[model samples]
Target: MARLGIVALLAAFGLILTATSSPAASTLRAAAAEKNIVIGTAVATGPLAGETAYRTTVAREFNSLTAENAMKWDTVEPSPNSFNWSGGDAVVNFAAANGQRVYGHTLVWHSQAPSWVQNLSAADLLPAMRNHITKVMQHYSTVDS
Candidate 1:
């Protein structure tokens, strides 16, 4: 009966995963409202812009959204002077349209960073970090408010 128990446990686990992953309209928002908590999820800008189902589900279910990768160091500012805001803008615009709040994923992290950041010396690191923050903040300032 040990083998049968394992199979039953796996089936129950699968059901739990499916139930948690399934999207429901205002489910998160409703739950959060009851407890005065905010529900949020990490998302990619491109998918929300391209996929109607994803955009609709995210906008309807969660009250807050965060860009999964668009705002990261490697993604937004790849090189020294080159900054890309296309993906970031998409996320911001979508959030605005859906009346959803946006939380900045992260500013500094070891992972998903470019080589320039990885190779920075002690003296240069602060300056680079400041510049990155300044530029990113400036770009999102209008949308943030």
Candidate 2:
């Protein structure tokens, strides 16, 4: 019994020491709608017609709010052949405008990439990497509008 209490205290202490940011969206707001088992919709999305009405409620029975997914590095800059920002850019823009925080899914990962990326020569790889970073960051940096 005493050991269990000590473990719990240690866990709580670790949590306090870790840097934290604004709470997750789930904690800030309730799901826009309720849900059940089959289907659901985000609170952000209007209309609870069909399964969304039920599923969403169930999913949120214990939580609030939904999160937006903003990931598309490979699709955005596939193959080092071209750059595409439509997916991620639109997300960042929307979040910024709506006063929502946008969490980048990842800046770097060991897997999940287009075929061309894996075959790139060092010469081709280096410049492609730099260019992609510069463009993606630049696009978000000017989100003042």
Which of the numbered candidates is closest to the native, going by highest lDDT?
1
Note the Cα lDDT for every prediction shown.
0.73, 0.45
Candidate 2 local lDDT, 12-126, one digit each (tens) = 5347445466442241123222222222112221122234543333233322222222344566667564776655655454444444444444443446455677877989877
In TM-score terms, candidate 2 sits at 0.47
**Where does model 2 exceed 4 Å of error?**
1-70, 142-145
For candidate 1, give the lDDT of residue 102. Answer: 81
lDDT string for model 1 (1-145, tens) is 3224334544554565567756533355665666777766677766677767677767766677778899998998899858998888888888888878887857778897777787789898888888988898988885432
- Number of colliding residue pairs in each model: 0, 11
Alpha carbon lDDT at 68, candidate 2? 25
Model 1 quality (TM-score):
0.74
